[model samples]
Target: MERDSQLELYQAVAVRLKEAHARVRSLQVPEGVRMALSRKLLAITAVAKHDLARAARRLDRLMKDLDEGRFPEGD
Candidate 1:
């Protein structure tokens, strides 16, 4: 996918996850509703693990890019 497209997809997922989190936080709900919401929240919480795995995978790619002498000057 193109970089722009990939970024758009990421943004969409982020918005969805934020909304889900807010839903988990703001409602006074029943036991069943709370249980279901907790499960959904747990799935969102797994994003931290997913992010760590992704960072590990990309560490080499990023290091390679840096070693190739690519740098952005601070403005």
Candidate 2:
């Protein structure tokens, strides 16, 4: 991607990540589930530091799972 387009994608991913984190925080799920989801989100955030595109895709999958009411299994 061009520099300008990559910057836009990164910004959009950052915004989506913020929204996802907030949504996870607002969920009424059990603490274990919440922590599991939070860990997944944090992992994606770390991935974003090295691979923005992969992170975006991972975020999309996570948000989709959440939207479909698929909370992570407890540890």
Candidate 3:
């Protein structure tokens, strides 16, 4: 129960951090800076999406292991 709670807290923190980063990244800027920021943000979003896809894959693997009774407790 404690571990589950901790995981939830960590997830919440991760979400908040991402949100804060996005907000900061959205700040106004000069035209040149805005263009660069837009490109950089696109790249960052692409990487983030790739990372999220990988995380989903890992979660699916974990679910499969759980279903197969392969993952150890406290893992």
lDDT of 3 at 35: 54
Count steric clashes of candidate 1: 0
Q: What is the lDDT of candidate 2?
A: 0.95
The positional error of residue 6 in candidate 2, measured at the CA in angstroms, is 0.9
TM-score of every model?
0.44, 0.95, 0.37
Q: For model 1, how does the per-residue alpha-carbon lDDT over 1-75 read when each residue is reduced to its tens digit?
A: 677875765565565556555754565655566565556455544653466334333433433433464433322
Across 4-57, the per-residue lDDT of candidate 3 in tens digits comes to 865665565456446534643564545565455345444544544556444434
The segments of candidate 2 whose C-alpha lies over 4 angstroms from its true place after superposition are none
Off-target runs (Cα >4 Å) in candidate 1 are 44-75
Candidate 3: the clashing residue pairs are none
Candidate 2 TM-score, true structure as reference: 0.95
CA lDDT of each candidate? Answer: 0.50, 0.95, 0.48
Pairs that clash in candidate 1: none
Lowest summed lDDT across 10 adjacent residues in model 3 is found at 66-75
Error of 2 at 50 (Å): 0.8
Residue 11 in candidate 2 has what lDDT? 98
